[model samples]
Target: MVELVFITPFVTGLLAFVLPSALSRQLLVLTGAVHLVLSLLLWKNTPQAWFAEYFAVTPEGLLSLLVISLLFFLISIYTTGYLAAHGLKSENIFTGFMLLFLSTMTMVTLSDHIMVLWIAIEATTLASAPLIYTHRSGASLEATWKYVLICSVGIAMALVGSLFLTFSMELGGVTSAMSFSALTPVAAQLDPAWLKAGFIFIVVGYGTKMGLAPMHTWLPDAHSEAPSPASALLSGVLLNCAYLGIFKTNKIMVSAGLSDFSGTILIVFGLLSIVAAATYILKQTEYKRMLAYSSIENMGIIALGTGIGGLGVYGAVICMIHHSLIKSSLFLSSGNILMGYKDRLIANTGQMAKQMPKTFVAFFAGFAGISGFPPFGIFIGELFIIMAAFKTGHYLAAGIFIFSLCVIFAGFARQVMAICFDTPAETGTGPAADGKDVSFKEPPGMIWPQYVLLLTSLILCFFIPDALYQTIVDAVHAIGGGLQ
Candidate 1:
C-alpha cells in the first residue's frame, strides 16, 4: 500500500511523457484519484512499507500523505481546466512533472531513513523545476534557475546533516538501524553534542526549503512565477514535506533530552520568518507574491507552535492542516483572477465582486480564513497557540505573535478590500483586457475546488472526526505534545 501511494504516480508520470496531451491530462486526474484512494487505505489499515528501513506509515507521515493526496487530487482537476484555457506549448511536460512532483512528495512523507529523506526532497526540487519554467518566459526562467540552485544547495546541507546524524550514532557505539523509529528508544545514548549539531544543520537545511526566514529567498520568485496549480502545491503541501523532516529530527532531539536546545532554535527562526514576511507583505504589489509572503508567515506560525510544544504543537498541526486548505484555495482563486484580468499586479485589479462574483466569494472567504477569522480552523489554531504561549510563560513571544498577526491582517485586509470593492476606473486603472466582453461566470472546475477546500476548513473548525483527532494527537505525542 505504501509503495502504491508513490508508484502509481511515478508510472503515470512516465506515461504522461509519451501520451498525447489530451490523454495525458486525463491520466493526471486518474493518477491523482488512485493515489488519494491508496493513501486513504493506508491510513485506514496502517500498512508497513515494502522497504521498512527506508519507509513506513508513521502518524506524522500519514497526516502529510493525506494532505498531499487530497490536495493533488483537487489541484489536478483544476489543472485540466487550467491547461485548456492557458493553451501551453508543451502540456505533456507540465503534466508529467506535476505527477512526478506528487511522487517525490509522497516519498518524502514515507521516508524513514535520513539519507532516503534527503534524496526524496532533492528529487522534489528537480521535478518541480520544469513546472516553474513551464511558461518559458524570461522571468519564469529566472525563477526556475533560482529555485533549483538555492534548493540544491540547501538539500546538500541536509545531506551533511544526515551524515552528522550517522556520526552521532557511531560515536555512541549504537548498532541499531539509523531509521527514525529505531533510533528514538536509544536516542539518549547518542552523543548530545553531535546530535544537537545535526539538529541545527537539519533545521537550517530543511528550513530553507520550508520558506523559513533568512533562507527563503527563492520562494517569492518561484511561487509568483509558477503556474497557479504548481504554486498551490508548493505552498500547500511541499513546505509541509520539508517541515516533516524538521519535525522528525526535532522528535529525536526531544528523545535525546535536548528539547530546549531544539525548541529555542525553532522559536527564534519562526519569529524571524514572521517578521520578514510581515515586512514584505505590507509592500507587496503582485497578488501572487502577496500570497507567497503569506506562506512564509504561516510557516513561521507552524514553527513557533512546534517549538512551544504541548498544546502549541497541537495548534501547529491544526495550523498546518488549515493553511494547506486555505492558502491553496487562495492561489487557485488568484489563477481565476489572473485569467479574468490578465494582470498579476494588485493595483491593476479592482471590483472583483462586480467583475467576477464567483471568484470573489472564494477569494474573500479564503482571505478571511487566512486572517484567522471565526468559523475557520486557522482562528482556532492561532487561539490555541496564543494560549499555549501564555501558559508556557512565553509572554513576550506571544505579544509579538499577536502584533504580527494584526499587522498581516491589516495589510491583507486593505489589499482584499481594494480588489473586491474598489472600481478600476476609480483607482485610475483602465479596464481589464476583455473586461467588457468576457462573461462573469468562471469555469466550474476552476472555482469549485476553492469552494471545497474552504468548506472543508470550515467543517473541520466545527467538528473533527474521531480517527483524525486521534491521528493528530498521536502525531504530536511523539514530540512531547499533549492537550494538558
Candidate 2:
C-alpha cells in the first residue's frame, strides 16, 4: 500500500507519455484521485512499509503526504480546465511530468533512508523542470535552467551531508543501516562535531531547495514562469518535501543533544529568510513574483517555529499545513487573473471585482488568509509561534518576527486592494479582460478549486479534528516539541 502511493503515479506518468493529449489530461485527474484515496487509507490504517528500512509512515511524513495528496487532487482538477482554456502546445509532456512530479514527492514523504531521501528530492527537481519551461519562451527557458542548476548544486551539498552523517555513525562504532529510525536510538553515541557539521550542511542544502533566504534566488523565477498549476504544487507541497529532509536531520540533532547548536542556526536562517522576503515583496511588481516571495516568507516562519521547539514546533506544523492550502489557492487564482488579463503585472490588473467577480472572491479571500487575517489558520499558527517565542524568552526574535509580519501584510494588502477594487483604464483591451461577455464566465473547474482550498483553510482554523490534532502533536513530539 505504501509503495502504491507512488507507484500508481509513476505508472500513470509513463502511460501519459504515449497516450493522446486529451486522454492523458484525463489520466492526470484520475491518477490524483487514486493517489489521494491510497494516502487516506494509509492515514486510517497506518500500514507498515514493505521496505521497512528504506521507507516508513512517520507522523511528519504522513502529514506531508496528506497535504500532497489533497493539494494535487485539487490542482489536477484545475489543470484539466486550464489546459482546455489556454491550450498548451505540449499538453502530454505537461501531464506526464506533473504525474512524475507527484511520484517523486510521494517518494520523498515515505523515504526513511538518508541517501534515498536525497535521491527523491533531487528527482523532484528534474521532474518539474520541464513544467517551468512549458511556455517554450526564452524567459521560461532561463527559469528552468536556473531551477535545475541551483537545485542540483544544493542537492549535491545534501549528498555530502549524508556522507558526513555516515562518517559520524562509523566514528561512533554504530554498525546499523544509515536510516533515520536506526540513527535516533544511537544518536548519543554519534560524534557531536560530525553530527553538527552534517546538520548545517543538510539544512543549507535542503534550505536552498525549500526556498529559504539567500539561497532562494532561483525560486521567484521558477514560480513566476511555471504554469499556475505547476506553480501551485511547487509552492504548496514541493517546499515541504525539501523541509522533510532538514526535519529528519534535525531529529537526529535533537537526539544527539546538539539541540542548542542546531536550533540557533535554524533560527538565524529562518529570520533572514523572512526579512529578505519582506524587503522584496514590498517592491514586487509582478503578481506571481509577489506570491513567490510570500512563499519564502511562510517557509521562513515554519523554520523559525521549528527552531523554537516546544509549542513553536506545533505552530510550525500548523503553519506548514495551512500555508499549503492558502498559497496554492492564491496561485490558482492568479492563474485566473493571468488568463483574464493576459498580464502578470499588478498595475495592469485592476477592478477585478467588477470584471471577474468569482475570481475576485477567491483571490481576495486567499490574500486575507495568506496575510494572516483572523478566521484563517495562518493567523492561529502565527499567534501560537509568537506566544511560544515570548514564552521561551526570545523577546528580540519575537519583536523582529512581529515587525516582519506587519511589513509583509502591509505590502500584500496594498497589492490585493489594487487587484480587487482599483479601476483599470480600458480593461477590455487586454486579451481576455472582457469578462462581461456571456462566454467569459470563469470555468467551474478553475474557480471551484480556489474556493474549496480557501474554505478548507478557513474551516480548519475554527475546527481541527481529533485525529489530525493528535497527528500534529505526534509529529511535533518526534522533534522534541511539547507544551513547555
Candidate 3:
C-alpha cells in the first residue's frame, strides 16, 4: 500500500499526459480515490516497503503523506470538474506535473537517507514550477521566476547544511549513515561549531521554502499567481515538506545536546513572522495576498510551538494538520470568489452572499475557522501551544504569541467582514444580467472540494483521537531528543 501510494500518482500522471485533455483530467478522479484508499490502508495495516529507492511507512511520515495525498485526491477530483466545464487547453501537462510533484513529496517524507531527502525536496521545486506559470501571462512568468530562484537558493543552503552535518559527525568516532537512528546515537560526540553552523543554514534555507517571514518574500507572489489548486498544495503540502527538513535537523541537534541553542533561532524567526503577517494583513488590498499572509502567520505558530519543545512539539504537529485543511479551504473559497468578482481586491468587491450564497457562506465559515474560532482545530492547536509555551517558562514567547494572534484575528475579521458584507462599488453594481464582468456561475467542482476540506477540518477539531496523538508524538519523536 505504501508503495502504491507513491507509485500510483507517478504512473498515472505519465499516462495522463498522453491521453486527450478531457480523458486525462477524468483519470485524476480514479487515481485520487485509489490513492486515498491506499493511504488509509497504510495508515491502519502492516508496513509495506517498496524497493530500497522508494517507499517506507513510518508513523510520522505516514501522517504527513496521508494529508498531502488526500488533499491531492480531492483537488484532482475538483480539477476534473473544473477543466471539463472551463476547457483549459493542454491541461494534461498539469496532471502529469502534479503526479511528478506528488512522487517527489512522497519521497521527501519517507527517505531514510538525508541526501535522498534533499534531492526529493529539490525535485518538488522543479515539478511545481510549471504549475505556478499555468496561465503563461507576464505576471505568471514573473512569479515563477521569483519562486524558482528563491526556492533553488534556499534548497542549496539546505544541501550545504546536510553536508556539514556529515562533516560534524566525522570529527567524532562516528561513521555517518544519515539515517535518523544512526545520526541520533552519535550526535552528542559531534563537533558543536560545525553542527551549529549546519543547522543555521538548514533553518534559513528550508525556512525560505516554508515562507518563514524574512525568507518568505517569494511566497505571496507565487501563491497569488499559481492556479488555485496549485496554491492550495503550495500552502498546504510544500510548507510541511520544508518543515520536515528543519524538524529533522533539529532532531539531530537535540541528540547532540544542543536543542537550547537551536530552538532560540526558531522562536525568533517564528515571532518575526507573526508580527510581519499581522502588519501585512492590516494593509493588504488583495484578498488572495491576505490569505497568503495568513499562511505565514500559521507557519509562525508552528515554528514557535516546535521551538518550545515538549508539549510544544505536539502543538506544532496539531497546527500542521488543521492549517493544511483550513488554509486550503480558504484558498479554494478565494478561487470561487475570484471567479465571481473578476477581481482579487477586497475594496473592489462586495456583498458575496447576495451574488453567490453557497460560496459566500463557505468562504465565511472557512475564514472563521482559520482565525481560530471555537470548536475548530486551529483553536485547539493554539490552546495547546499556549499551554506548552507557558510550561516551558517561555513567558515572553507565550505572551507575544497570544498578542500577535489577537492582532491577526482583528485584522482578518475587519477585512472579511468588510468585503463579505459591504455593498459592491457603485461603478460595478448590478448583475452581469447584461453579461459584463462575471460570465459563469461559481464552479461546483471547486466549491465541493473546499466544502469537503472545510467540513472535515471542523470535525477533526472536536476529536483528537489517540492514533493522531501518537502520530504527532512519533513525528516529534522523529525530531528525537529535542525537548529533553
What TM-score goes with each of the models?
0.98, 0.97, 0.94
Clashing pairs in 1: none
- Superposed by TM-score, candidate 1 places the C-alpha of residue 36 at a distance from the truth, in angstroms, of 0.8
Q: Model 2: how far is 296 from its true place, Å?
A: 0.2
- TM-score quality measure for candidate 2: 0.97
Specify the poorest-scoring 10-residue window by lDDT in model 3. 428-437
Q: Which tens-of-lDDT digit does each residue in 338-370 have in candidate 3? A: 777667777667767667777878789888888
Q: Candidate 2, residues 1-484: lDDT per residue as tens digits?
A: 8888999999999999999899998999999999999999999999988888899999999999999999999999999999999999879999999999999999999999999899999999999999999999999999999999998998989998999999899899989989999998889999888888889889999999999998999999999999999999999999999999999999999999888888889889999999999899999988999999999999999999999888899889889999999999999999999988888988677788878899989998898888888989898888988999999888988999999999999998898898788765464345333434323569899999999998898888788899888888888999999866
Q: Rate the local accuracy (lDDT) of all candidates.
A: 0.91, 0.92, 0.82
In the range 131-230, model 1's lDDT, one tens digit per residue, is 9999899999999999998888888888888889999999999899989999988999999888988888899999999999989999999999999999
User: What's the C-alpha lDDT at position 194 in model 1?
Assistant: 88
Candidates in order: C-alpha RMSD to true structure: 1.3, 1.7, 2.4
lDDT of 3 at 185: 76
Error of 3 at 5 (Å): 2.5
lDDT of 2 at 331: 97
lDDT of 1 at 77: 98
Model number with the top TM-score? 1
> lDDT of candidate 3?
0.82
